[model samples]
Target: MKHARIGHQSIPRWAYLLFIVLAVFVLYRIFQHRAEVAKASQPPVRPVLVAKVITKDVPLYLDEIGTCSAYETVQVQAQVSGQIIARHFQDGADVKQGDLLFTIDPRQYQAALDQAQGQLGQVKAQLGLDRITLKRQQELRARNVTSPQDLDVAQGTVNSDEAKVKSAEAAVAAAQVNLDFCNIRSPINGRAGLRLVDVGNIVSGGNAGGGGAVLLTIQGLDPIYTDFTVAETDLALVRRYLGGPNVKVQTDLSDGSIPPRLGDLYFIDNAVQPGAGTVKARAITPNPDRALWPSEFVRVRFILDVLKDAQLVPSQAVQISQSGPFVFVVKPDNTVDLRPVKPGQHQEGDMTVIENGLKPGETIVITGQLALSPGAKVDPKPYDAGNPKSDRQVAAKGAM
Candidate 1:
């Protein structure tokens, strides 16, 4: 029968369209939620600059501040009192041993020497005449014609004249020495400083003990000394290798005008300096070109030993944490492992020696370490020191 269907109404076309639209919107929402959850489950991949661990012979060394000093310093002084009549050398001239440096007036000394010679000649003539008289007296005594007292008197006169001759000879020697002193000579090979006494100035003689007026300063410059100090705490380590064959020193000037110089450790103070807690040390460096000067400050590196086949890496790859120094090592799967390392001395060319905790051929992060964590994924890029962009990135990241 027309039945209950007579009360049923047909569905509207607009209702069907609205239902389809809601179903499609629900499906989109579900898919979007699933995508967000998946993203949250995965770790973020960060980009970083990295380098490979290398191995080489690395030097174990200590760095200290030092100063260059002349190997030998001599203050040239007048050895004999006289007026400086002439200067034989220019200021700042390099001189050899026995080189003439100045000339003093010799006329007075020569006159004294002449006078002594004259007196010696007079004494010699008298001695000859007295000896002849003694011989005549001796002959008379033998013939019993002269008294013994006369013979004795003649002998005495001859002896007295001989004594006078000897006294004159002593005076001549003294005068000759004074004449030779007129020419001043350099005693050592060195570089002469400015002349303190001019050509016309009078200077007093200095004794062998370095007394009197300093005429000029001469310092030995070749093979100079680099003087430095070591802290008391490190004294033991330095002493252990004090004279070892491998132990050496390297010196660098702040100006960098000359190349770094290598030398041997020359001296070390026996006692530590009171109140300073340091001991003085010296290095003997060859300075054939005279590039190093006295009292010039320099950077000193005391090389204790060389570690053979030591693991090395870029210095920036090592980072310090609260526990100690650590490095980010990249794994084969592009993940990083935060590894603790025992770092050794930093070397030239931005390299550092790894005493422990790292192996050769391992990849390590040099930059972009701030965003890294243990087991974190990374896009490792090769570190290139020549790349400006990489350097800028490193600087911006504040990589250690």
Candidate 2:
């Protein structure tokens, strides 16, 4: 280096050589330290728990609490008041229209009818006398012994008697009507309720129990109605399903854990209640066994429509993140990836309908997604649900 230097600068050859060796060694050490640090900082690729692609049809049951109602209900009341002379129907008995339910005292109505009949008899006897008198007058006039004015008076007497007889007949008819009203008959065919009065108790004209206490409640149990409500958010979607030219609703109502009865939708309220934030809907159910009762609460199901071949996922896989509802998609390389999704109706138990952003064949992280990061290496554990044989397989394969 000194030999190559110009006159202004001079350097020894050994000094230059030593400086280059030290620079080369420092560069090598730096590279070695950098490699060690990079290896140490890189996370130990942890084996993560994962699930395999599960392919099956998920049953979707739209669940909501609903109530039951009777198709036709009537309150049995006594029309005529007297005294509770007899009870014709038992409590909770099924009755037909025109069946006698209660019997009030017929004595008062019978007395009135008897008085009317007596008046009618008296009027008939007087009319007979008038007829005889008129005939006698005519006979006398024909013999030139009776005056014309006297005969005319006899005719007027016969006419007055006839009008009196007609008036008495009308009175008898009205009294008969009142007597018939003493027997309280059922207006419709239905299930009857409890009896309000005993045989000896007196009943006022208005009600049987003397107060507003219902004498009996009769409800039609054959074809019962079940009422329910649905959220306003589903209105448009359900309307589209039910508003078609010839569309109808399919319903299910259950009591307790027993399987619900299948019913048909028949009525929907015209107006939506803004305060309740729901629409009232009704369905008809066959109550052949009297399983449905009046005022009994029942669960109602409304089938808006069916989603054909819609992608579905478990509710657990879906997580609410900063963006929106998303799922941890498990890639084939045993790494976790995030995917957004749109959720549909919530079905029974662990199933939910995926409206959008899901594929049928794609594997979603069903478990252990909370601690996953993008591109993190994982040791996937194939979890086989349902079948006992699959559980054995996981254990036998040593991937537990």
Candidate 3:
């Protein structure tokens, strides 16, 4: 009590008063600093707000890798052994079915055919003589003028000559077929590759390596096939979305970097592939200009089904916390609320479907999630300010 009334134990009054003021000022500074440090240490966690946008028909697509190939291909080879007499059609030229591709030397086949025909004539003449003798002998034997043994000999000779004639006829037929094969023709209408053999070169049967010569190759390129695969797990989706005839596909050229050509799907594999766990599919595209070449790697896309009037939100708008999928809904009072949502399929650009949560006209943080609190003041801007395209799509649906 004495020290409190007389500062500094009976010291000067001005000195005691100054010391008291200095102590009071020091205490005020400490209290102010503590208040500031507490505020900084417990800073608020911000929330990224996005709009619970209404989802409408969004163009969805299933993209995959694929390859292009000709509809049909044929390798032309010689069927009969002969010298390659002449070559027809230029390299890489489009040819029609039955077009003469090469002309093998027909002289050997013709000579064989002529020889068989000559043999047939000789056998026929001998049979004629035998038949005449047999008829005479049978007539005489009936009258007892010829021996039975003579009639039997004549009959046997006629039968032997007839057999020889039949054999000669078969040989002639085979020779004629071989002659026809000397004129090599295209089996199908397509583009031709190159002539592997020059004129006057010897070619054996089947061109069995064609004496180191391959005639040509032809490929059908008008309507081409583009093949791709989808995951086996998505079989249900393929059945659902691919049923529509309007379902479109496109193929990219040059490592999928180029723009894709519009095509339509026509084939699907019946079973899943074992090694890759994928199901194969094929699409046909008209290549009047030969834009899709044979064996070219391609990037493909299937236009997914169009969702009719679905509720869509930004992909970033949906956040996963301890609870589940949620969006920070900004109320009119600028306070944020955590909105639990059930999401559906995603669509083109940056929109997704809202299955069970969120309603129209609900504003949520699209960005700045790291700075949001439950009751913190929110400066809600348009959801697509930074992303103009998304903003346009959002604005098209009337989301600000």
Better of 1 and 2 by lDDT: 1
Residues 52-170, candidate 3, lDDT per residue (tens digit)?
57747754578787888888998777788778878888988888899998998899889999999999999999999889999999999999998899999999999999999999999
Candidate 2, 1-400: lDDT as tens digits: 5665675355667888999999999999999999999999875454333443334444333456676677788876665677777888888889999999877789989999999999999999999999999999999999999899999999999999999999999999978987887888898878887776678877666434364324678888888887888788877767767754333333344535455676778788778897998888878877787777777766665665555666666666678888899887777776767878898776655667787787777777655554566776555665444554654443344332
Give the per-residue lDDT digits (tens) of candidate 1, residues 217-314.
99999899999999999987887877778999999998777899999989889999999999999999999988899999999998998889989898
Ranking by TM-score: 1, 3, 2
Off by over 4 Å in 2: 1-63, 118-170, 207-214, 241-258, 264-267, 270-274, 306-343, 346-399
Please identify which of the two predictions, 1 or 2, would achieve the higher TM-score against the true structure.
Answer: 1
The lDDT values for all models are 0.89, 0.72, 0.77
With a 3 Å backbone cut-off (N, CA, C), the pairs that clash in candidate 2 are 47-379, 48-379
Q: List TM-scores for all candidates, in order.
A: 0.74, 0.57, 0.57
Q: Give model 1's clash tally.
A: 0
**Residue 207 displacement (Å), model 2:** 10
Q: For model 2, what is the alpha-carbon lDDT of residue 249?
A: 35
